[model samples]
Target: MTLPSYFLDNPYNVEGTEVVGNKLSPENELIEYFVQFRNDDLLDTLNTFEFNLEINENLILQKTLMENKDSFRNILRDAITMGTILLNFDRDDMVNINLQGKRLRNNIKINLEVPSNITLKELTASDYEGDVVTFEAKVSYWSKKRTITHMADYKCPDCGDIITRPFKSKIKDRCVEDKVFYEFFKPNISEDTRRITLREISDDFSEGKLPVSISADVYGKTVWEIELSDKVIVTGVFRSIPLRMENGKISQEFIPTIQVISVQNMKTDKMELPDMELMKKFQDLEAEGKLVEAVIDGFAYNIYKKRNEKKAILCSLIGSIWIGQVGKGNPPMIHILFVGDPDTFKSTIMKYVINVSDNCVLADSTTVSNAGIKAIAIKSDDGRWSIRAGLLPEYHGGVVFLDEFGDLKSDIYADLKAPMIDGWVSKHVAGEDFNGRAETGILASMNPTDGVYDDSKSILENLSVLKKPLITRFDLITKFSIDFNNAYDTQIGEHFDKCDFEGKPESFLKDEEIKLFINYVKTIT
Candidate 1:
């Protein structure tokens, strides 16, 4: 059965209250629960039902509904209907009916807020089957929002009576025309339903685990407002779809899906800025016109050579952000490509900036793909298409460090043109149009071919792998060479010796102070 929405439902089970035995049906049980617990929310604009596993442990414990999520959600829907009907019992038709022809209960959405669910550790331990669980994940993809009819406003063709039947009970495709995407898609989702793709955070992938990705058929205004890369807590009932065979027929194989109950963005994960004292300290630096110099000093202090390269990167760091995008004269963020020989400390240099900078993602060519850097179209077992954002949109307002940039795939190199030149990119993939705004800075590093930097060759010749058009997008190119001059080598040797001799090399700022200063500058800049 294809169910993408819990659309306009019939008012049911409002015979005062069901006075059955202790083993109350799920719908009656929820009504009793709402009356006793969530009564205030029932009358509120957003009809949210907050269910805490820790608090409402007893709600489904005796009834055994928690084990079967489909049945649980089905009953919850019915409960919402019965509760809405209960409100009409006291509502005066003349007074409650507003100019918009909407009752107070017209937009009463049943948002089920589950505070706890399966975790990464728990997922490895046992199979969840089809349990209704909650978990936090990053939104990777979204189908463009389309309007869908919640309830039929037109009359039945056979009988001129106003058709107020439950959307499901009505003959499929007779009144409500829903396009089939394996699962049905009504798509009139302006107020109600939307489809989004959620993937487990990158931490799971770093553990050499296949990060889980699932399609969520979400119902509500809240989840639809979430943008790409927004970390969200989603509550949904798991289900399996029959996998399609190569011959375009349904096979015995099954793939999992989630019918989302409700979703909320995980707001607490945002970076917490430092206290007033540190913030004010940077403000004072700006006031004294020494903020830029102070930020440069806070950068890599122990690295011996590449003084000019350091300044170039500092230009990228400050200039990339401070350079406004508002005015016509304003330029996009500065992009820098560092090509050098081995032991030139390119990795060390980029890592320092990556560590100091907020929202920095390191994508090495050895691992990432073209689609991984930009957006890609993903198709689920059911024939639905969604566009998943790549590294650029994930760290949209921030910078990305592309390591081992020379070894990057040729196709991926060609893909970098649109983004580096223009601040936006569009991919017309799988019959879906995906456009993303990436006001992001690029600071990429590469070791020259054969582990040696050739100063005699032109800038483009030294880096033969990257295309000319793509290379031109970079605002600055810094080349690092290993100078074997006796004086320079002795100085480098002395710096290394000092590191081994003393506990550590001297720095202009402490580790904690450096982080505070960088983040502080990022904000004001």
Candidate 2:
């Protein structure tokens, strides 16, 4: 077959004899050709063009490589084999081919930025099978990265000829002998690898039901840059590997994993200015000095008294926006522990916060374990490392409410210290290290050791069962007491009566006003 006249144009002006020769392959002409597709300058920086690959838009690539899929397939294989050559990056660094396009149309279009890309829930097995894709997801499990040699020298026993083979290839005789014999020599190359499992996470800052897991293998700088439970947008090629069962039997099913090429951390927060009108209203409220009071009243109307405690919860609701650079700024997250006797309505307060805040993560203390704090890394029966995410990591950048906090094991309470201070948990398991960051505020309620507050004794005396270090971590430690003489305290009795019904009691602040207040508070620097 004769090649098209356009193939000989050589827009890149690269020196080569053949149209698809080793001296100058079409892979080398890809960037240059795309640049000229829009009449872009050859000398300009590559960043000038935006190449976002939306997983939903697969035809963009299929359309581009339609004529010569095999040739580019070989290019992609070579790119992975010698990753450093054409891209001018390390062998471990991934090379992404970003293809952006419109939805529901045969014709594709490229945009500088693709707004509102498809979520992980929208992706099917066929969408990602053998092509490069991009999507936003949360990190559920992070495996400890290990350095292994890729290229190794081996001497064939038959011919005594030194030959090179990748780490996967078994020693064999290609030099004339029917029987294979080889001697191991030193390795020549090393690679950094960390495999991470990503799940379709709800971006609403609430802990929702996670979909099935997708495997993503991050290399080089990305291995260190990505963290567990982080919301990230990643671009990579979908690769399928043979599935091995627990008994080491290779199954017919193939597991899909992404060879990550680029990754970007997506900002996640509960409160968002839905529109400019809401933003204007928030600005007006801020100017009037009613925004703060409105926010406090929004959630506190359900709870009876304890104005100070309500204010503390409000502060926790709108955590500090500033992250310290020079030194640790005031711990942005406010952890509140309510120690009270039975019938103090401590659990009621917790329930109120859970209902009011959209970003609240509620869990019973009975259900929490040491592994529930961050991530649990366990060696599977198959001798492979497996990780499970805990409540704290899953609810990062949100509120964590533990009702019946006193019932938690001693070790569990001890585990809260790291998350309280540093806002993250670091654990090393199965010969791998993992750091899970949960920048979350905590609200917990528990009964005192003696089941009642002793005013005659010191504050520490009443809470002797709990450790001092754990007690000190709480920003506000309030004791809820009932004035026993007044059995029909209108406030407390009315609260219980109101809560018994289906509907919530009417609040002075309207729901829209509260939402506006939340939107306003989130805008604070």
TM-score of 1: 0.71
TM-score for candidate 2, residues paired by index: 0.66
lDDT of 1 by residue, 418-442 (tens): 7776667677765766677776778
The lDDT per prediction is: 0.61, 0.59
RMSD of 2: 8.7
Best by TM-score: 1
- Candidate 1 clash pair list: 146-189, 147-188, 147-189, 148-188, 148-189
Q: What is the lDDT of candidate 1?
A: 0.61
